[model samples]
Target: MAPGSMGTVFIGDPTAKLPDDLLVEVISRVPYKSTCCCKCVSTRWRDLISHPDHRDKLPRSTLAGFFHATSATEHHRHLSHGYLSVSGNWCRHDAALSFLPKYESLEILDCCNGLLLCRGRKSTDPKTLDYVVCNPATEKWVTVPATKWSWDMSSACLGFDPAVSSHFYVFELVPALAWNPIKRDDYSIEAVGIYSSKVGVWTHPIVLDDPIEILYLSGGAFLSGVLYLCSDNNSVAAIDLEGNCRIIPLPTPHDDPGGPNVYVSRGQLYLTIQGASELSFWVLEDSSSENCWTLKLNISYLRLFGIDYSSSEQFYGVISAHPEHNMIFITKGFRLWY
Candidate 1:
């Protein structure tokens, strides 16, 4: 059989026999699309292709670019979305989500792996919005049913790891009016709305215990089966798939001007704190119990950006960390650096 033509070959001869090891090697050499199609050839072939032992040999997905929303200024009335291709080759994919149903406004809320979570406002009812999960590569999407507290959601996040499961999940953090008599003005996250693709429905919101308020702009990190968000109380709030929750104190000083940002890299949860003159990176040793952080890197702004730090100007903000490497991406002024 011709190399990289496993899909056509296997479909043509379903009964064709080959050693399991050799079949795995051949399938691994083909394109990812062909590898996925090979799973339907037979029970044995599907088992071989799905085997965890052969995962390292399989072809992996490539980074395309980034999706960003345009900020609305005095001149612009509405927010607009756009895509930036890593290779500057935009022709390969459709940046505009033209395949989706029409909506009054569509905002990209969060992205995980290759999927995006969007909020689409209905044209008929401008006040009502639906959550949409879409795969830009395949130009396919599904709208998630709204929960009772969907309108009260303060933030939403996408959780998807192809290696972990074929399905994806949407997590919406719902805020509640402060019931504490002492802190009436303070808002606390009271529940989480979880939607699983496999079930095709949004489960009832799971109420949280000792709920804390989260910084909506700080973003969040979803690692393993839990979601971690930066809390206003100078700590991290972790919520798992079962609705179990815990709060872990921040490792760095709470007075840091840059605050703390959470990220996931190499199957681990990472946190970065920016100080007056330096940036520090930390990795959670164990999120389940210990909640200890190990300082991974500490670098001065002078050495990193060749710029002296001053109280007058904010120098940089972290974009994200490389999922597979020790490197990180940050933005300084208008330029992005790693």
Candidate 2:
């Protein structure tokens, strides 16, 4: 077997076997198209291809970069999708979408650091809803301290600066209304409360905000060291780690001027009309502004499980939204040699 070598190798001998570690090593370095064919060679090969540590062993930043579809088990309404990783064979995860198994309970904003910044809600059983940040990959969790003095929060974000080369994930807790004892100017995100695991201390970055309120979300992409979010007005907002905001209008979708849009994947946003059959991608060029956004691919799959151009980094394995998950299989998209 050769790394980065395209095409399938058939073991016609019928008794040919490969070691587990060596099989995994070769598959990790090969293209997804070749791996798909090799996985069918044997049950042992399938296990190696789907191994959890296979991602960690390879240069891939994330073992699995696609969203995991988890159901709530209530009415089968597709629950929120999160970063689900395949560990060995079982799918594991760690994401911020850990909502209360019940409503009226505030969802905790968990930081990978040994802390959680949560809003103090006066409803529901706090015991059944203790804030927990569990690394589903390793099943490690940390309970958070009580939030007695923080304001009511609506949203938050978690980020890590590669320049700092830190292992811990830092978070910014966004309060619904800033805490003000004597009606102070506490309505905006003034400073980013920094948490450093190396030093075991949370430092507050310098404060700066034009509007008294954080009018955007911190959930887009850190393309070039900046955080971005798709606004309600079909525009993209870029945010700095220190809580600064800059708005850039994404091009109107398909000239409809009125269509539903969503941030499908980080760095790759998309717009899809509800009743229309057209799908578009938000392509941002390095030398242009948001207004210069271009639409690349158009999905004619009417209402498929939606479009995700951001996940184009690798050959995507999309399970069906219906009963038969094999409707979509891996196609030979990109060929390369390691």
Candidate 3:
């Protein structure tokens, strides 16, 4: 068989031909699309592939895509529809993110697994925000009701785990209130509100035992059930499901004016720092250990795009890293490439 191709499967007597174990190996090696097609192959294949254990054993899809800035004119606020390629190429799908209704302004807060956490606010009620979790590929979306602290939240994230449960959780981190005992100038996020899809209600705000002062908070990434928030102060806040918070310092301070991009890929935490000429990657070896960061990869601008690092005309940003692949998506101007 050709490389990366789904090898053919010959089904016959279970005892003499293809056993259940060998059938699983064949299905697991095929691409996700092929695996989906197997449902129609035979009742045995369908049942074998759809079984809970068999489904969990299958490998995850390697390709993941993200939509960058929109190309809408002043009258419209639609994001341009396209995806970045693994080879750093841009492909336009000629689609817009009109999935959410009646929201003139929409922003992508974060993406977890295959779902996107989007923040939307209509022009009429600018103060109120609406959060939605959706799969762009399946065009399936669910709107999360606003929690009491949603209006005061500094950042939000989507927590999802297909293995554990079908329902996902939406978390909002609210900064310290003015009337609290902590000084107003402290500027720390002391409260968190979590909305559980399983229960369809937002829980009361959970106060942290030790609140960390944060200058600015980027969106969060959920890794191994813990939500990690990157801040502008060269630190990260790790919050567990129980609302316990731990402050973790970065290995090196960010040189770029904008904060570094942090994400979780394949259960490992990664932080990317953009330099003048090269992009430095640091992997969190052990979240609990000191000096946990280890330098992983550095890509130079000259080699990445064949452009001079000193050039003043072009600007680039790392979009995201693939879950299991060693590829990352980046954008230059309006074009996105993996």
Candidate 4:
């Protein structure tokens, strides 16, 4: 009405009476950062912003960047974040995770569905560790309760599925206790403890029947309702909600005997092995069989980046692999490259 309009008189606030579905649709189209900010506008906005229905309608959160550790001082270690682009390059930026408490050192235990499961130890006692789950996009985090079990030889991973449930879970892997050392292996019983966000507590540890040794470098990937873990013997172990366990051996043999990085991408499981000059990727074709592993891609540094594969330059470990985008994030020294 104020501008050049032909007999068009705008009524009261248009958004005031807008339908919740329409508002949610508009808000879902915006960036996640903007949607987070809108949560403070009103109670309705807050509810819609975080509601599972609204979040499900939004786009899937893909791999954006990662937080990399640089160096450690007397007290705290320095961390930097890097963003990945479609051009296969990572740009560094400063990320002050204010949600994280002050600690001597912090380790990224796992990253899944836009959340980071971090473990940190205080300066007074490095043996005692605290855990935190953080969503860097919204700067929202929650401290995980201290586990009832011992931290010695324990590892954990994050499990989340936006489709099946709004809540996520944490799976902690620990070794079984031994009354007598001479009779049985140290890792004869694999204990799996789950922490659910909805219940806000850690459930009783689920003990597996088999005594499978978990590999130190074996990362976990959750698909469907089961979590897949790589064992020290280059075999994959799958555990479901019902406490059933199955061991699937890898078809392609490896000489190093080192566990490759395991991850889930686009409803499929993948494994990546880094060699001196090339990186090999294997994908699980038949989920039902759980034995077929096809070598999907082998990328050589010389061919991909025009860098000498046999160069004496320092190379960093593979940080993450984006299956949907066909990119892998690697760190070399202090810099991250894709």
Q: In the order shown, what is each candidate's alpha-carbon RMSD?
A: 11.0, 10.5, 9.2, 10.0
Top lDDT prediction, candidate number: 1
Model 3 lDDT tens row, 1-338: 89998887767744346788898898888877677677777888878876777756775454535554556789865654445434221222223566567686777766778777888887788877789888776778888887666665556778987767888888877777622645564357777778888899887778887665654534567887788877667888888877778878888787664467777777788888778778888998887888889999888888988996569476677767777767677768666666
TM-score of each: 0.75, 0.52, 0.68, 0.66
- Comparing 2 and 4 on lDDT, the stronger one: 4
Candidate 1 or 2, higher TM-score? 1
Pairwise lDDT winner, candidates 1 and 3? 1
How well does candidate 4 match the true structure, expressed as C-alpha RMSD?
Answer: 10.0
Superior candidate under TM-score, 2 versus 4:
4
lDDT of 4 at 47: 80
lDDT of 3 at 160: 88
lDDT of 1 by residue, 90-131 (tens): 234566687888898788888887788998888999888899
**lDDT per model, in order?**
0.77, 0.43, 0.72, 0.69
Clash tally, candidates in order = 0, 2, 0, 0
lDDT per residue as tens, model 2, 1-338: 58888868765734346666776777778654566676688787766666776745443322332333344677653344455333223454445435323323344443322223333333465433333334444555444333332334444444443334543434344442454344443335444443434565455543445322433322333434455544455455566645566766656633332233333233343433222344444456542453566666555432343444333343322221111111122211332111
Where does candidate 4 stray beyond 4 Å?
1-61, 71-94, 101-105, 121-129, 176-189, 275-277, 301-316, 332-335
Question: Candidate 2: where are CA atoms >4 Å away?
Answer: 1-33, 42-44, 47-134, 139-151, 161-164, 167-218, 253-276, 287-292, 301-338
TM-score result, candidate 3: 0.68
Among all windows of ten consecutive residues in candidate 2, which has the lowest summed lDDT?
318-327
